[model samples]
Target: MAHEGKADEQLFQLLANLLHQVESLTNQEEVELRTKIEALGLEVTKVPSKSLKQLDELEIAKELDKLSEKLDNVDEMISSAMAADPQVQSLLSDTADIWMPVITASADERRNFTPSVGENSETEANCES
Candidate 1:
């Protein structure tokens, strides 16, 4: 039971870490992209995940999921935003190649991740009991 809670906590921490990484790349790299992302309403930070309640964990999970959907459609968003505003098109053209790939790769890695063998075994044992 405790392990399950720990696992949930770990999942929340991982989601928050992803959020922080996105912020770090966008925050320092391109203000334009940052502006686009900030409009999505993510409030994640460097909070210590261990101290948060389970409900907070659920909220973080939902927010991260929401952010992922928008991120997955980034190219389309860029295209539409660029079409709508010529100024942003020029700005995006300058830096879109710089940090977007890193963010995408990070998201891919997160999506394709498999839990460690030990973690799976532990979870299985917990379930069997």
Candidate 2:
């Protein structure tokens, strides 16, 4: 039982690290998306072409879907980490209070900007028991 507890601790730490990485990657992707949008906006303002502009819009939509998937994975990691310990569950609850709205807003903003976008197909699966 003692060894099992130690293993659980290690697992929790691993989950935390993984969640942090996912958060970082998601943030980086958001920045990249914003940059692409700005660049495309500039192009549209300067030399607006339907084909190029439409392709850029499609790319942005795809990137947004990818971002949504990444955020879902981060949420799943947090949920799994919290399940490992009561303390972690409480901590995650607090963190979610701060983070969940921002992630949801980000997704909503993307959808609002791109009305002709496709829905995301990323589903979170539980692998840890």
Highest lDDT: which candidate? 1
Worst 10 residues of 1 by lDDT: 39-48
Q: How accurate is candidate 2 locally (lDDT)?
A: 0.44
lDDT of 2 by residue, 1-129 (tens): 343333333334434443444446445333443444355334323533466444587898997898679668656755775685565565445444333433345433423432112211111112121
lDDT at 34, model 1: 51
lDDT of 1 by residue, 19-64 (tens): 4444464564455655555543233222345844465778889988
Residue-level error in angstroms, candidate 1, position 84: 1.0
Backbone clashes under 3 angstroms, per model: 0, 0
TM-score of each: 0.32, 0.34
For each candidate in the order shown, give its overall lDDT on alpha carbons: 0.50, 0.44
- The residue pairs in collision within model 1 are none
Please report how far candidate 1 places residue 120 from its true position, in Å: 42
